[model samples]
Target: MTISLSKDEERDFDREIRPLAADPRCQRMKRFIQHGRITTYEHSMNVAREAFRLNREWHAGADERRLITAAFLHDYFLYDWHTHGDRLHGYHHPRIAAENAGRDFRVSARTQKIIRSHMWPLTLFHVPTSREAWLVTLADKICSARETLFERGSGAGHR
Candidate 1:
């Protein structure tokens, strides 16, 4: 079953994501698929929500703004990786995402690290070096598994 956010959670989520969401480039993700059955927009939303929840509930001492922004931007690469098959998406998308984010937003170095390293073990050497980066990485994996396995129907990009 799908979980719905409370009003307060929804408000906070909207507030935190407003800057990124306001951009047409980021908004276009609503049409791009990620994982198996979710849009990149949905997948990134899940990661940002979970990363915020973990930081708030667990008191991870990470920079809250950076965590939320980076989580949202961690998959901001604009293409459907499934169709663009020349390279391994998992191994390379983080860097591409970081580049896109840097171009589209005023990202801090920590935010860049968070985006570049969220792929974690898949990327090997691109390790998460900050508390925020670690949270984003873990949250991304969790959200990815849920999107890939539990969600239904491929997103609009496949069609």
Candidate 2:
């Protein structure tokens, strides 16, 4: 069964989500929301929502605030990976996002580490240690893959 958040829970999400989504970097991300490419905003929201679902399933005691924040900002680097004309995104985007997040927001050390290590065992060369980080990593891959498939016009067959 799917768990649904209560009205108050959704209110809490709006409080935090609105501010972050309004941030300048995220505003830039919004422009790509309909660029015929999978957007950062869409990817970030999907990851957060999926991670929240997974957290609920595991009965994990992770802080919801941190999990949402990390997932939403995980792809804050805001570049089109395809247009980069290189595969450097697999190696570079996380660090770029972490640095920008550090500068633009008052993020926790844990959150920063989550962002920096989200590409783990690939770009990071190590697996994440925190429960939230692991959740975000898994959610990122799941959401990104789905979005990629959707963008490729193979959504019906793939799903």
Candidate 3:
């Protein structure tokens, strides 16, 4: 089931994400599918929402802005990985997304690291080192698994 934010939560989330959402580059994610029929934009928003919920539930005291930003931009690599799947997209996307976030958003070193490390043991060396990084990493895994497993079309032809 899809999650819905409360009225107050929606206000807070919109405030936090509005600046990024206004950018055409970020908006372009609507055209790229991340899993099943879910667009990258939708997946990123879900990851951000889940990360925020996890942080609150665990009382993790992570920086909210940093956590949300990193979560939403974690897959900001800007290309359709499917048509151009080189087998390295899984291993390389974190780095590419981090670079794009840094360049486009001027994110902090901490935020960039959080984005870079979201792929975790899959990337081996790029382990999450901060509260926010770990939150985004776990949230990414949760959202990706949900989309890849429970989404429509019989789980056919997805990354």
Candidate 4:
């Protein structure tokens, strides 16, 4: 989890990550628990950071801005799905998130598509079509598995 970032890379990350991370609507994600103790905001950040790193490390020629933006907004469904909203959260949230992203962020069609496909086979028909989408999907599963299994310590309380 501790990837060494060069100064240039750090700057690039900040440049790409800061605005969306700082958005008040995005900030609202801190109110919802995602994994055991992790906030959706934190989870989204993990996914975005990991996907960005993977894009560079794997030399996956994804557009950095689109990749980073889509990754952060992939889970932008803006609800506490565990307690409320649709029971089939897994199957529907990607579409909701993508819609929210489109309305609020005016993301490109490709970026919206990436956000929509992050859930992959669980979503079945909404398969990821681009390297960027696949990278976000992979990073999301990796971060979620780690958080769901390991971050559920007794001390980590829901806000």
lDDT of 1 by residue, 78-136 (tens): 89888988478888899999998888787977789889999999989999999999999
> Model 1, which residues run further than 4 Å from truth?
1-7, 153-159
Model 3 ranges with Cα > 4 A deviation: 152-159
Model 4, residue 22: what's the lDDT? 93
**For model 2, what is the alpha-carbon lDDT of residue 90?**
76
lDDT of 1: 0.84
Candidate 2: tens digits of C-alpha lDDT, residues 8-125:
7667666767888877767787655423455677667777777877787788877888998998988888667667665777788888887777878878888988988898878746
Clashing pairs in 4: none
Count of backbone collisions within predicted model 3: 0
The residue-level lDDT of candidate 4 at 50 comes to 87
- For model 4, residues 1-159, the per-residue Cα lDDT tens digits are 334567887899889999999999899999988977788988898898889889888899998999999999999999898887677999999999999999998998999999999999899899999999999999999889878867753355544
Indicate whether candidate 1 or candidate 2 has the larger lDDT. 1
* Model 2 lDDT, residue 120, Cα: 84
Clashes of 4: 0
Q: What are the Cα lDDT values of the candidates? A: 0.84, 0.75, 0.88, 0.89
Residue-level lDDT tens digits of model 3 in 1-159: 355677886788789988887789899988899888888998998899899888877999999899999999999999999987678999999999999999999999899999999999899999999999999999999989988877743234545
